[model samples]
Target: MASFSEREQAFENKFKHDAELRFKIIMRRNKLVGLWAAGLLGHTGDKAEEYAKSAVESDFEKPGHDDVIAKLMADFQAAKQEMSEHRLLKQMEEMLDEAQRQITAE
Candidate 1:
C-alpha cells in the first residue's frame, strides 16, 4: 500500500497536471476564437496567426476571460464588423469544446 506521503504527492501531481491541462485548453480556445475573429476581420495567413497569438496573450492580462472578450470586441468594432457579444460568447464556448477535444486527442 502507498504511504500517506506518497498519496499526498500523487494528489499534488494530479493537481498540477490538471492545472497545466486547463491552461493549455484555455490557450487553445483563445487561439481558435482568435482565428475565427481574424477571418471575420479580413486577416489571413500570417496576420491571422499573429492575431491569434495576441488573443492568447490577452488572457494573461486578467484572471478570467473578460480580457479576451474585450480585446476581440474592440477589434471587431474597429474593423466595422458586426458581431454581437452573445454570439461571440457562444463561439467561445464552442471553441472551448474543440480545444478540449484537440488536447485530449494529443
Candidate 2:
C-alpha cells in the first residue's frame, strides 16, 4: 500500500511538470509568432517585444488558437499588411515546433 501510494505521487508530480512545460511551450510559440508578425508589420526592437507580449495575452481570450488568429488577422488588416491565413498558420506551427525543442532542451 505504501509503495502504491508513492508511485501515485510520482505520477502526479510528473503530470504536473508536463502540464507546466506544455503551457510554457505554448506561450513561447505565441511570442515567436508575434515577433514574426511584428517584423512583417514594420515594428522593431521594443515595439516588437510589446507586440509579442500582446500575442501571448491574446491567447487568454479562449482555449486554443482562435483568439490569436483573430487578433492577428485584425491587426494585419488594420496595418495594411498582406498576410495569408495559411502563412500565419504555418508560422505558428513552425514556432510551436521550435518552442517544444527549446523547452525540452531547458
Predicted candidate 2 versus true structure: per-residue lDDT over 9-97, tens digit per residue: 99999999999999999999999999999999999999999999999999999999989999998999999988889999999999999
* Candidate 2 segments whose C-alpha is farther than 4 A from its true place: none
| TM-score of candidate 2 on Cα atoms, chains taken together | 0.96
TM-score of each: 0.97, 0.96
Error of 1 at 70 (Å): 0.2
Report the C-alpha lDDT of model 1 over 53-75, residue by residue, as the tens digit: 99999999989999999999999
The root-mean-square deviation over C-alpha atoms between each candidate and the true structure, in angstroms, is 1.2, 0.8
